[model samples]
Target: MTRVLALLLLLLALPLAACGNDDGEKETLTVFAAASLTTTFEQLEKQYEDDHPDVDVRLSFAGSSDLVAQITEGAEADVFASADDKNMAKLVEADLAAGDPAEFATNTLVIAVPPGNPAGVKTLADLARDDLQLVLCAPEVPCGNAARTVADGAGLTLEPVSEEQSVTDVLAKVESGEADAGLVYVTDVKGAGDKVEGIELPEAASAVNHYPLVVVEGSDHADLAQEWVDLVLGAEGQQVFADAGFGPPAS
Candidate 1:
């Protein structure tokens, strides 16, 4: 009778263990995105988790080129969203993209200065002043490349004190008063709230960057990845982006 009781106890313990495992198991969907998407994506991440109880949404944000490098080096990522087509093309050229990338938003450059505009910056031409310390993204970065395009179109040359790898870093320099001004996206300046003042650049219209989204070629959660893509392309996601100051996707 003691042996029979032991067998029943073991069977009961097995079922409990199985139940525990089921409760703890979750599917993870990792998304690698541009640094500029941080705020908007974080909001979406929360919504996605609330709606999909069984799936965990993880986000990694960085410069588009850096994210591409990570993906190419075999970092496990389900999706990729770039701030520009140039960086997105890198993944396509490597054949690391699962399908044709879809344009999700557009962004244009703006001059970000400290509150009160102490430097009295008013236009892209003001960034070229020798006395002002300007910060800008590196040439390889989308923001930096766009800055160059805008500067060229305006017939001016920019001499930034530092070239950052990401637009956020450039914005940081301006916000901290470490630099008199910086070139960043319109969305970034808007998102900065009162921390920085935005000066519109007419030249910016010429270098508008179209943001793109795609699923990584070898993603284990391809269906989940596509779902995330669909969410971003859907009306809800666009509204979130619009609220954050992102422009509509290029036509």
Candidate 2:
């Protein structure tokens, strides 16, 4: 009967759709990382893919806070690499990170400006000016915390025009000329190339940010997750990160 045939076709279509979805899954390893890791991670992703043809590395880069929140909500990430120890420790506290995390690298904060320094900003104190539109990472994030420490050490109060969720966002504002000056990691300046210029500030010498990476606990793919972490911490991974301008890890 035609009616029976139609019902059978519909049921067949349902399994086909489900099959497609399952095929799409394809052994993915989800990595939650800080926005600043974009460039280096992309390179590592490619290298990793070439090495493991069957496994796909899926990355979601954002403010470490946001990523941590997602993981806490059970987003099912296999790995986490934060810009600072705070976020990594938060994962450890939540029993989200596997094993002991290690400090991978260090980065110094700098005052990033448009390529030409059109605002004529020259010093960290210049960020205090009411006329120069400045962007800074929110204090909840690692860069922001470093910014604050630098500001306090210099006895300066910076009222940024915008408190960005991530260092990359702050750099973006400067790159787009939306902001006259912004505080960002030295690695960001290196990554931005000519899009932005770095003006090293003495206050920046005050606080150093250390990055840490870890595999999450309860990962179904713990071995794969740790391989990714090992790549980031091992000589090859460390070389990639260091070449990108991150400092030697805390010994």
Best by TM-score: 1
- Give the TM-score comparing model 2 with the true structure, all chains together: 0.89
- For model 1, the superposed segments whose C-alpha errors exceed 4 Å read 1-24
- For candidate 1, write residues 165-227 as lDDT tens digits: 899999999999999999999889999999999988888899999999999998999998998
Clashing pairs in 2: none
Candidate 1, lDDT over the whole model = 0.93
Residues 180-211 of candidate 2: C-alpha lDDT, one tens digit per residue: 99999999999989999999877676799888
Return the lDDT, model 1, position 147: 93
Top model by lDDT, which number?
Answer: 1
